[model samples]
Target: MILDALFFLVMAGLNLFFWAIIIAAVLSLLTGFGILDTRNRVVWTIGDFFYRVTEPALRPVRDRLPNLGGIDLSPLVVLLLIQAAMLLVAAIQGYLIRGGVYF
Candidate 1:
Protein backbone atom coordinates (compact mmCIF):
# COMPACT_ATOMS: atom_id res chain seq x y z
CA MET A 1 0.00 0.00 0.00
CA ILE A 2 2.78 2.43 0.81
CA LEU A 3 4.58 1.62 -2.40
CA ASP A 4 1.41 2.23 -4.38
CA ALA A 5 0.87 5.57 -2.71
CA LEU A 6 4.48 6.56 -3.31
CA PHE A 7 4.15 5.64 -6.95
CA PHE A 8 1.00 7.71 -7.28
CA LEU A 9 2.69 10.69 -5.65
CA VAL A 10 5.67 10.36 -7.97
CA MET A 11 3.41 10.21 -10.99
CA ALA A 12 1.56 13.31 -9.81
CA GLY A 13 4.82 15.18 -9.33
CA LEU A 14 6.04 14.22 -12.80
CA ASN A 15 2.75 15.34 -14.32
CA LEU A 16 3.03 18.68 -12.57
CA PHE A 17 6.58 19.14 -13.82
CA PHE A 18 5.50 18.21 -17.34
CA TRP A 19 2.78 20.86 -17.30
CA ALA A 20 5.18 23.41 -15.83
CA ILE A 21 7.60 22.81 -18.69
CA ILE A 22 4.83 23.24 -21.24
CA ILE A 23 3.57 26.43 -19.65
CA ALA A 24 7.06 27.88 -19.48
CA ALA A 25 7.71 27.07 -23.12
CA VAL A 26 4.57 28.84 -24.29
CA LEU A 27 5.21 31.83 -22.05
CA SER A 28 8.76 32.11 -23.42
CA LEU A 29 7.45 32.24 -26.98
CA LEU A 30 4.83 34.82 -26.10
CA THR A 31 7.40 37.01 -24.42
CA GLY A 32 9.81 36.65 -27.31
CA PHE A 33 7.12 37.66 -29.81
CA GLY A 34 6.15 40.70 -27.74
CA ILE A 35 2.74 39.23 -27.09
CA LEU A 36 3.62 39.20 -23.41
CA ASP A 37 5.40 42.16 -21.92
CA THR A 38 8.06 41.45 -19.33
CA ARG A 39 8.45 45.12 -18.48
CA ASN A 40 5.40 45.15 -16.26
CA ARG A 41 6.27 44.03 -12.74
CA VAL A 42 3.34 41.64 -12.76
CA VAL A 43 4.44 40.11 -16.04
CA TRP A 44 8.00 39.86 -14.91
CA THR A 45 6.97 38.27 -11.66
CA ILE A 46 4.89 35.68 -13.45
CA GLY A 47 7.62 34.91 -15.91
CA ASP A 48 10.17 34.63 -13.17
CA PHE A 49 7.96 32.24 -11.28
CA PHE A 50 7.85 29.91 -14.24
CA TYR A 51 11.54 30.25 -14.85
CA ARG A 52 12.42 29.44 -11.27
CA VAL A 53 10.26 26.38 -11.24
CA THR A 54 11.61 24.99 -14.51
CA GLU A 55 15.20 26.14 -14.82
CA PRO A 56 16.68 23.61 -12.42
CA ALA A 57 15.22 20.75 -14.40
CA LEU A 58 16.05 22.33 -17.73
CA ARG A 59 19.53 23.71 -17.15
CA PRO A 60 21.38 20.43 -17.51
CA VAL A 61 19.48 19.56 -20.66
CA ARG A 62 20.18 22.99 -22.08
CA ASP A 63 23.89 22.80 -21.40
CA ARG A 64 24.29 19.33 -22.91
CA LEU A 65 22.30 20.04 -26.07
CA PRO A 66 23.67 22.04 -28.97
CA ASN A 67 22.48 25.59 -29.38
CA LEU A 68 20.08 25.76 -32.31
CA GLY A 69 20.21 29.49 -32.77
CA GLY A 70 16.87 30.90 -31.55
CA ILE A 71 15.27 27.52 -31.18
CA ASP A 72 15.28 25.73 -27.82
CA LEU A 73 14.64 22.00 -27.64
CA SER A 74 15.42 21.50 -23.97
CA PRO A 75 11.80 21.75 -22.95
CA LEU A 76 10.87 19.03 -25.43
CA VAL A 77 13.64 16.86 -24.07
CA VAL A 78 12.49 17.53 -20.51
CA LEU A 79 8.96 16.58 -21.41
CA LEU A 80 10.22 13.35 -22.91
CA LEU A 81 12.27 12.69 -19.78
CA ILE A 82 9.25 13.35 -17.58
CA GLN A 83 7.23 10.87 -19.58
CA ALA A 84 10.02 8.35 -19.42
CA ALA A 85 10.23 8.69 -15.64
CA MET A 86 6.50 8.21 -15.28
CA LEU A 87 6.65 5.11 -17.43
CA LEU A 88 9.58 3.72 -15.50
CA VAL A 89 7.76 4.18 -12.23
CA ALA A 90 4.63 2.59 -13.61
CA ALA A 91 6.65 -0.33 -14.89
CA ILE A 92 8.21 -0.86 -11.49
CA GLN A 93 4.81 -0.69 -9.89
CA GLY A 94 3.51 -3.23 -12.36
CA TYR A 95 6.37 -5.57 -11.67
CA LEU A 96 5.82 -5.31 -7.94
CA ILE A 97 2.12 -5.90 -8.37
CA ARG A 98 2.72 -8.99 -10.51
CA GLY A 99 5.14 -10.30 -7.99
CA GLY A 100 2.46 -10.07 -5.33
CA VAL A 101 4.57 -7.70 -3.28
CA TYR A 102 2.91 -5.32 -0.89
CA PHE A 103 0.91 -2.74 -2.76
Candidate 2:
Protein backbone atom coordinates (compact mmCIF):
# COMPACT_ATOMS: atom_id res chain seq x y z
CA MET A 1 0.00 0.00 0.00
CA ILE A 2 2.73 2.43 0.94
CA LEU A 3 4.73 1.58 -2.15
CA ASP A 4 1.72 2.27 -4.32
CA ALA A 5 1.23 5.65 -2.68
CA LEU A 6 4.90 6.47 -3.11
CA PHE A 7 4.75 5.55 -6.76
CA PHE A 8 1.68 7.73 -7.22
CA LEU A 9 3.43 10.65 -5.56
CA VAL A 10 6.46 10.33 -7.80
CA MET A 11 4.29 10.04 -10.90
CA ALA A 12 2.33 13.13 -9.87
CA GLY A 13 5.51 15.13 -9.38
CA LEU A 14 6.82 14.10 -12.79
CA ASN A 15 3.45 14.95 -14.37
CA LEU A 16 3.56 18.39 -12.83
CA PHE A 17 7.10 18.95 -14.12
CA PHE A 18 6.02 17.83 -17.60
CA TRP A 19 3.32 20.50 -17.61
CA ALA A 20 5.79 23.07 -16.30
CA ILE A 21 8.05 22.46 -19.28
CA ILE A 22 5.13 22.95 -21.65
CA ILE A 23 4.04 26.13 -19.90
CA ALA A 24 7.55 27.52 -19.98
CA ALA A 25 7.75 26.86 -23.72
CA VAL A 26 4.38 28.55 -24.31
CA LEU A 27 5.34 31.53 -22.18
CA SER A 28 8.53 31.92 -24.17
CA LEU A 29 6.53 31.85 -27.37
CA LEU A 30 4.11 34.48 -26.13
CA THR A 31 6.93 36.75 -25.07
CA GLY A 32 8.73 36.21 -28.35
CA PHE A 33 5.59 37.12 -30.28
CA GLY A 34 5.18 40.32 -28.24
CA ILE A 35 1.90 39.01 -26.93
CA LEU A 36 3.22 38.94 -23.38
CA ASP A 37 4.59 42.18 -22.06
CA THR A 38 7.66 41.12 -20.12
CA ARG A 39 8.31 44.78 -19.41
CA ASN A 40 5.39 44.64 -17.04
CA ARG A 41 6.46 43.55 -13.56
CA VAL A 42 3.83 40.81 -13.27
CA VAL A 43 4.72 39.30 -16.60
CA TRP A 44 8.39 39.47 -15.87
CA THR A 45 7.96 37.88 -12.48
CA ILE A 46 5.95 34.99 -13.84
CA GLY A 47 8.33 34.52 -16.71
CA ASP A 48 11.29 34.58 -14.38
CA PHE A 49 9.67 32.07 -12.09
CA PHE A 50 9.07 29.63 -14.92
CA TYR A 51 12.55 30.19 -16.24
CA ARG A 52 14.19 29.44 -12.91
CA VAL A 53 12.09 26.33 -12.49
CA THR A 54 12.58 24.87 -15.94
CA GLU A 55 16.01 26.08 -16.98
CA PRO A 56 18.02 23.81 -14.75
CA ALA A 57 16.51 20.74 -16.35
CA LEU A 58 16.77 22.22 -19.82
CA ARG A 59 20.31 23.54 -19.68
CA PRO A 60 22.07 20.21 -20.00
CA VAL A 61 19.85 19.08 -22.83
CA ARG A 62 20.43 22.36 -24.57
CA ASP A 63 24.16 22.01 -24.18
CA ARG A 64 24.19 18.57 -25.73
CA LEU A 65 21.90 19.34 -28.65
CA PRO A 66 23.20 21.11 -31.75
CA ASN A 67 21.85 24.62 -32.25
CA LEU A 68 18.89 24.89 -34.60
CA GLY A 69 18.76 28.69 -35.00
CA GLY A 70 15.71 30.15 -33.21
CA ILE A 71 14.34 26.70 -32.66
CA ASP A 72 14.52 24.85 -29.34
CA LEU A 73 13.79 21.16 -28.97
CA SER A 74 15.02 20.63 -25.39
CA PRO A 75 11.57 21.01 -23.89
CA LEU A 76 10.16 18.35 -26.17
CA VAL A 77 13.01 16.04 -25.29
CA VAL A 78 12.50 16.64 -21.58
CA LEU A 79 8.78 15.96 -21.90
CA LEU A 80 9.47 12.67 -23.61
CA LEU A 81 11.95 11.74 -20.90
CA ILE A 82 9.38 12.55 -18.24
CA GLN A 83 6.85 10.33 -19.98
CA ALA A 84 9.41 7.53 -20.08
CA ALA A 85 10.06 7.94 -16.35
CA MET A 86 6.34 7.78 -15.62
CA LEU A 87 6.07 4.63 -17.67
CA LEU A 88 9.00 3.13 -15.79
CA VAL A 89 7.33 3.90 -12.47
CA ALA A 90 4.12 2.26 -13.61
CA ALA A 91 6.01 -0.79 -14.74
CA ILE A 92 7.74 -1.10 -11.38
CA GLN A 93 4.43 -0.79 -9.56
CA GLY A 94 2.92 -3.48 -11.74
CA TYR A 95 5.85 -5.76 -11.13
CA LEU A 96 5.58 -5.34 -7.38
CA ILE A 97 1.86 -5.92 -7.43
CA ARG A 98 2.41 -9.08 -9.40
CA GLY A 99 4.68 -10.41 -6.63
CA GLY A 100 7.98 -9.78 -8.37
CA VAL A 101 10.74 -9.77 -5.81
CA TYR A 102 13.69 -7.47 -5.81
CA PHE A 103 17.02 -9.15 -6.33
Candidate 3:
Protein backbone atom coordinates (compact mmCIF):
# COMPACT_ATOMS: atom_id res chain seq x y z
CA MET A 1 0.00 0.00 0.00
CA ILE A 2 2.78 2.42 0.89
CA LEU A 3 4.73 1.51 -2.23
CA ASP A 4 1.71 2.19 -4.44
CA ALA A 5 1.15 5.54 -2.74
CA LEU A 6 4.78 6.49 -3.18
CA PHE A 7 4.70 5.55 -6.84
CA PHE A 8 1.63 7.72 -7.39
CA LEU A 9 3.23 10.66 -5.62
CA VAL A 10 6.38 10.36 -7.69
CA MET A 11 4.38 10.12 -10.88
CA ALA A 12 2.43 13.25 -9.96
CA GLY A 13 5.65 15.11 -9.27
CA LEU A 14 7.10 14.03 -12.60
CA ASN A 15 3.95 15.20 -14.41
CA LEU A 16 4.16 18.59 -12.73
CA PHE A 17 7.80 18.98 -13.69
CA PHE A 18 7.10 17.95 -17.27
CA TRP A 19 4.23 20.45 -17.54
CA ALA A 20 6.34 23.26 -16.11
CA ILE A 21 9.01 22.66 -18.73
CA ILE A 22 6.39 22.56 -21.46
CA ILE A 23 4.77 25.79 -20.25
CA ALA A 24 8.13 27.51 -19.96
CA ALA A 25 9.05 26.45 -23.49
CA VAL A 26 5.84 27.87 -24.94
CA LEU A 27 6.16 31.08 -22.92
CA SER A 28 9.75 31.49 -24.11
CA LEU A 29 8.70 31.21 -27.75
CA LEU A 30 5.84 33.67 -27.25
CA THR A 31 8.04 36.18 -25.44
CA GLY A 32 10.84 35.79 -27.99
CA PHE A 33 8.47 36.49 -30.89
CA GLY A 34 7.04 39.55 -29.14
CA ILE A 35 3.66 37.90 -29.14
CA LEU A 36 3.58 37.95 -25.36
CA ASP A 37 3.98 41.46 -24.02
CA THR A 38 5.21 41.73 -20.46
CA ARG A 39 4.28 45.38 -20.04
CA ASN A 40 2.07 44.60 -17.07
CA ARG A 41 3.83 43.97 -13.77
CA VAL A 42 2.26 40.53 -13.28
CA VAL A 43 3.14 39.41 -16.78
CA TRP A 44 6.67 40.70 -16.43
CA THR A 45 7.10 39.01 -13.07
CA ILE A 46 5.89 35.64 -14.32
CA GLY A 47 7.93 35.89 -17.51
CA ASP A 48 11.07 36.86 -15.65
CA PHE A 49 10.67 34.06 -13.13
CA PHE A 50 10.24 31.39 -15.80
CA TYR A 51 13.16 32.70 -17.85
CA ARG A 52 15.51 32.66 -14.88
CA VAL A 53 14.44 29.19 -13.77
CA THR A 54 14.43 27.51 -17.18
CA GLU A 55 17.33 29.20 -18.97
CA PRO A 56 20.06 27.27 -17.22
CA ALA A 57 18.69 23.94 -18.39
CA LEU A 58 18.03 25.33 -21.85
CA ARG A 59 21.30 27.20 -22.44
CA PRO A 60 23.48 24.11 -22.77
CA VAL A 61 21.10 22.53 -25.27
CA ARG A 62 20.76 25.81 -27.16
CA ASP A 63 24.55 26.14 -27.39
CA ARG A 64 25.03 22.59 -28.65
CA LEU A 65 22.28 22.78 -31.26
CA PRO A 66 23.05 24.62 -34.48
CA ASN A 67 20.73 27.48 -35.31
CA LEU A 68 17.89 26.44 -37.58
CA GLY A 69 17.04 29.53 -39.53
CA GLY A 70 15.16 31.88 -37.18
CA ILE A 71 13.45 29.22 -35.08
CA ASP A 72 15.23 27.94 -31.96
CA LEU A 73 14.73 24.18 -31.54
CA SER A 74 16.46 23.79 -28.21
CA PRO A 75 13.28 24.14 -26.18
CA LEU A 76 11.64 21.46 -28.27
CA VAL A 77 14.56 19.19 -27.56
CA VAL A 78 14.32 19.94 -23.86
CA LEU A 79 10.60 19.20 -23.84
CA LEU A 80 11.25 15.87 -25.56
CA LEU A 81 13.88 14.96 -22.99
CA ILE A 82 11.52 15.90 -20.14
CA GLN A 83 8.79 13.70 -21.60
CA ALA A 84 11.24 10.87 -22.02
CA ALA A 85 12.28 11.13 -18.40
CA MET A 86 8.67 11.13 -17.24
CA LEU A 87 7.88 8.11 -19.39
CA LEU A 88 10.91 6.29 -18.02
CA VAL A 89 9.79 6.98 -14.48
CA ALA A 90 6.28 5.79 -15.19
CA ALA A 91 7.60 2.62 -16.79
CA ILE A 92 9.79 1.87 -13.82
CA GLN A 93 6.92 2.40 -11.45
CA GLY A 94 4.71 0.14 -13.49
CA TYR A 95 7.37 -2.54 -13.52
CA LEU A 96 7.86 -2.40 -9.78
CA ILE A 97 4.14 -2.54 -9.16
CA ARG A 98 3.72 -5.54 -11.43
CA GLY A 99 6.76 -7.29 -9.99
CA GLY A 100 5.27 -6.96 -6.51
CA VAL A 101 8.27 -5.09 -5.22
CA TYR A 102 7.38 -2.95 -2.21
CA PHE A 103 9.49 -0.80 0.04
Clashes of each: 1, 0, 0
Residues 69-89, candidate 3, lDDT per residue (tens digit)?
887787778878877877888
User: In model 2, how large is the Cα lDDT of residue 72?
Assistant: 97
Question: Model 3 lDDT vs. the true structure?
Answer: 0.79
Winning candidate number (TM-score): 1
TM-score per candidate, in order?
0.94, 0.94, 0.76
Model 2 TM-score relative to the real fold: 0.94
Where does candidate 3 stray beyond 4 Å? none
In candidate 2, what are the lDDT values of residues 1-103, reduced to their tens digit? 6776788799999999999999999999999999999999999999999999999999999999999999999999999999999999988877877775532
Q: Residue pairs in steric clash, candidate 1?
A: 1-103
| Model 3 alpha-carbon miss at residue 46, Å | 0.5
Regarding TM-score, does 1 or 2 come out ahead? 1
* Alpha carbon lDDT of each predicted model: 0.92, 0.92, 0.79
Q: Is candidate 1 or candidate 3 better by TM-score?
A: 1
Full candidate order by TM-score, most accurate first: 1, 2, 3
